[model samples]
Target: MSKEQGRTWDTSLFKRVFSFTKPYGGLLAIILTIITVLAILGPLRIALIDHMVHHFIEAKDLAGLRTFALIIVGILLGETFLNFATTYLSQKLGQSIVKDLRNQLFSHITKLRLKFFDKNPIGMLVTRAVSDMETVAQIFSQGFLSIIGDILVLVFALTMMFVINWQLAFIVLIPIPLLIIATNIFKKAIKKSFQDVRKEVSALNTFVQERITGMALVKVFGRSKREAKTFSEINNRHKKANIRSIWAYSIFFPVVEILSGLSLGLLILYTLSRVDDPGVNFGELAGQLTAFIMFINMIYRPIRMLADKFNTLQMGLVGAERVFKILDTDELIPNTGKVIKHDFKGGLSFKNVWFAYNNEDYVLKNLNFEVEAGETVAFVGATGAGKTSIINLLGRFYEFQKGSIEIDGEDIRDIELNLLRDNISVVLQDVFLYSGSIYDNVTLGNPEISKEQVVEAAKLVGAHEFIDRLPDGYDFNVKERGGLLSVGQRQLIAFIRAYVYQPKILILDEATSSIDSESEMLIQNAIDKLTKGRTSIVIAHRLSTIKNANKIIVLEKGEIIEMGSHAELLQQEDGAYRKLYETQFDGHEV
Candidate 1:
């Protein structure tokens, strides 16, 4: 478990959380009314019992006793109904708020720039969207409104106690100060425990998610035991944190019971002392004593629950603090451009562009390049030579720190974000396919592309043969991350997917590097057909792959070293592209 921070109640944070309840204001009002009624009913029930003892039971009037019994039962039934309504309505309100909050959080996450995702772990985000959201819901179902009802019960119970017998009320409250001190200690200790538990939960989730996703790597490296040891350590810390909270509850609840027992003992002792008084009316005194006993229970129960409820509220506020932090983040890419264009000529240019994933560490420094409409340009470089970064910039996944990128003579930043991306299709080396039918993966749930369109695209890309051979044809499930398909097959599906979109610009980033020679030939043929009239950018490690490119640009250390047709670059014996080609081809004829 991590070291716990000092937790203090922020009233402003509480108010912010309360704001989610605005949409269900009417239901909340009804719940509040029900709570108020419930509070009064507890005290009123005790008074009625006292009345029956004094008037009916003492007089032995059977008819009066029956009538009073029926009235008391009726009140109990009404109270029960009110309690049920409060529970149902409060939970309904909580779930509704959670639905809205989850939707907003997910939508906000989608709008955040790719840079934000680079810094945040997916598992931690899952915790925020899943577990922490449920915690916020409890703010309504079990924390906020419930605390209010407990307080009201306390207030009403104390008032009735004073009304019935002020002296006895004072005697019973004598142990309350000690209870308060104990409760304060428990609350502080438990708050720290809750914080520690929450942290460990996130850590555990992150560890498990990462390990499971990379389980193949772990097994191949024979690190299962080592990973298990690490997981055990994290799980143990989570268990220890929970145990500490449980220990606090164990000590605190017994302490509450002891204090309550002490109050009852004092009440009994005081009544016994007054029994011998000559002027005391024994029946009336008996009735008051009975009412006082019931009132003591009413006061102490909510008092005990108040401590727990207050902690629930505190936990919820802590969750809200974390959630609101995400909501308040200004990392979203501003899509303020009003220009929406469907037809793109795909003339692209980069003018003195500078970019860095981190501050001042330029990955693409002062880069300048241009590709006229319908021309296919290739970027040939070693790993980290800023090949992928250019694609990311074109799609506006990450904003460049300086200079401008334009599409068809207009700054891409001024073009509507969706429209800008919609006109481009990229086939990455690592194709990600959702767990669904092949057809679904191809269309990406786009209703505009019909089954006939998907089939046609698959055929055009030569992916139709393999897809047709599958047991379910186009309906075959790829399982998680396309695990059911070979790397080449997944790449073919990616080609089909891109082709179906009919984008104005196409990008192939090492798309054929991992595939077999046969698959590469198929993909190459598909690429030739797809890039016919569209402006295309190709990033490749295989020199032969881009031999036919209209322009081949060689990059080293974020700076372009050479640019020309493959044959022209080959003519320069010492040029970067020529040297790279020689290394790959190794004296083989071009």
Candidate 2:
């Protein structure tokens, strides 16, 4: 179900898959060599049966018969051991390749631009990262090396059969061409069916993951029945897609079985017809016929399994196409700059910046502003006035269409993205806390920051009191998104996190909007300490909170209509900031 382009069964795709396996070349070489050996040894057991009949059974040599029985047992043991090794090694190799691939997918996705995530669903990405990867692994575990063994066995079986008795070999292989043709047709049909199955699987996973995540919302909206119906529809489509693959397999295997039976019948008929011929030895007839049956199975078994193997290959290729599409995507923000030093003094400027999520509809149009080092600038605006967008641009989370942003006199594009982001800290209105201990959440797994440092930062942000009151103190686990914590508590934790980082440029995007008056006062005190000597950008909805800011930039339609100190902006009779201040902080002296 995604409109993502798929790869055809092409050599290029195989090359990409094989590149991952190249590191395990020694192991693969051993597997392939053992497979070739197995192919050669496969016919030897049939030859042993022939030898037993001609040299031991008919000749009435009990000693020779005992020896032949022991040799057969020995061959079976050897084959079993080798077979186990091949399977074990193949699976191990596939798992290793998948591990590397999954890591790469995760890393690449993390590096991709925010727009890619905006366009793609998280559930669909989960399918690609997890389920699709398993299918890709199956290409090696069940399809690649096994196919090689099957093909080699077929080749060796045919060669040995022809060498033993050309006439019988020809008769036994009479239906092979038809089997090959049928398999080819089946390959094409099954490939398309497999693609359909994979698509449905992705759709099903996407539906389930999204529904589960939004289960609470569904219940609140009283649309549980509607969602269930939608889920059932998706589930049924997945089932139907699987059944389509099953149907192809069902039609194909029986046809292969019939062809195999026909080959055996032809061999028997041809051998029986040759009984009166002078060149035919009646003594070896039984032995030769037994060997011919083994040869037929060896050749036809691979032919039968080719359809299944081809199906596996197709599923993997489709999965690979989806994965490679992400890997190959050029939508990543190019990190061409090498500057790693982030000791910024925090003078920032946006020079005639134009931005749009989609190119046609501009959100921020020709916006220009400047903030001096250690200045706290508060942006006041209506909801869509591009306030939060400014923080996003400053952090380089998304790319702007036109113009440039400079930090500490260096163009943002020239400054390394990580370095630029490292010097800037953003505390959004909605704080996201990972599932970890309070200490870990504050430090964010940074080994450089000690527990003492975490405690000190929490105290500085006024988070230490509540954190210390908890059973585990700083070690208290903040469960999913800090669900156990109150909104004020989470905001305090976020303040602690930002404080611990000690970024040169601090951004509070309505950071205290959800806090109660008590918590807001504490946060306001923390903000004073936090923004003492840093470039701080504040986007606030509560006009009273930003009255003492060094500068207030009031935005409307992506451009500044008023820019001055809180008192100076209030003096303008028709200013937007004055109207906003009057409406929100009315009768309260600045």
Candidate 3:
């Protein structure tokens, strides 16, 4: 059982769920009115039957019987129409609220910082946005309003039974207290079961999603049997959770049926005792007994369903609480800067910078660097030497703990987040392409970028030759993550995408590290054209790639030990850059 199952009906959460209905107030009022009328019609039909039996059927008046039967039939038709309207309108209201809530949830997630995604799993989020939202919809369509209609029916039925014959009504209600106690027990048990079911469902989704995405790795490592066994275990847990709810239902429903039967038996025994009364008319008494039986059935029908509806309401409230927790998160990157510059100069400087993924265990310690506008600066370091961390800090994907990063002498924090990112583009080693046509991927659904502009950018970056070789040229569809394309081909597409944006600053992080010699040559030529006039930052494992850079900075343990041109740095016999170059090209340790 979840912690939330211990609490009573959360009135504030209930109010929050209903608040989404404010936009459809008129429709809700109409649904309520229909439900009330439907409630009245149920008992009214029973009264009509009792009256016809006493006035027409008992007297053997056939003509009056025919007329009264038609009247009841007409009321039945109207009641049916009202039932249909209430069902249709309530579902419409529920779906509308779900749509709005999902939109808000998705929008809020998009604005959250990257750190949030790093900490949360994508499959858990997918369950919250999709399945949980559907559960919340049931609070309107199947849970709350249906329970209200059922209660109103009970109220009218009870009032009519007492008005016709008070003594019989009292006898029929003798077993109701026991039924109420049973219902309360059922509600608590079922609610705990539902909470378990929801938790298991989230776990199931997360496990399946991760395994499917990593299927290739599992097969390559020959762990298929192991993964299959793990999946079966998760599947069994989900099955067990649902079985718990089924167990509660199996016991509770039978108990309701038994109590309802006991109430009918009590009513019949009491009526038999009053049959020989001197003042009572047999016909009138028989009609009253019949009407009371109908009333008992009507009352017990809703009572039997009340436990199930209450469980649905509880589950929806649980789902809402989970979704609201995410919506309430305060981890969004602040975008309060008012500065917007159309022609941004890409001179960058970092002074006394310190950063870490967590706490003060810094990855880059007191780092300092400067890049003049339109200068190409290269950074060479081993893995985990704070290379990618610099790109993340510059884009404000993560925050730095100390010191300042400035662009064109203005602090990056003072610049609008979107505007600052718009002026820079980074092409990483692992390129991600959405499932769409090449044209769509290149433009990324932006209306401002024309097909001609995309074509021009492709030609400039030498990507047009391969793209033109495809059957559909720019119209070719690239499946998920560009799985159909080779590594070099995908890199070429990334270069074209970056070039089309015409960013003032360009970042290439291991862009040429994984490809054939021919593809690397093509990308190298494309890189020369791309960085000709833009401020560029290059991170490379290969020492030959950055020989022409204006300045080469060698970093070891997050601090720069050497900075100069390639020849100048090589001239120093003990320099880090000289040693790294010799290890790669001369095939020896220095």
| Cα RMSD to the true fold for all candidates | 1.7, 2.4, 2.2
Candidate 3 lDDT trough over 10 residues, lowest sum: 581-590
Name the 10 consecutive residues with the lowest summed lDDT in model 1.
1-10
Error of 3 at 211 (Å): 1.4
Model 2 lDDT at residue 159: 82
> What lDDT tens digits, residue by residue, belong to model 1 across residues 276-365?
999987777788889889888888888888778788878878887888888988897779777885468989999999999899999999
**Which has the higher TM-score value, candidate number 1 or candidate number 2?**
1
What's the lDDT for residue 116 in model 1? 91
Off by over 4 Å in 2: 1-8, 272-280
Ranking of all candidate structures by their lDDT, best first: 1, 3, 2
Better candidate by lDDT, 1 or 2: 1
The TM-score obtained by model 2 is 0.94
State which candidate, 1 or 3, has the greater TM-score.
Answer: 1
Q: What are the clash counts of all predictions, listed in order?
A: 0, 0, 0
Off by over 4 Å in 3: 587-590
Model 2, CA-based lDDT? 0.86
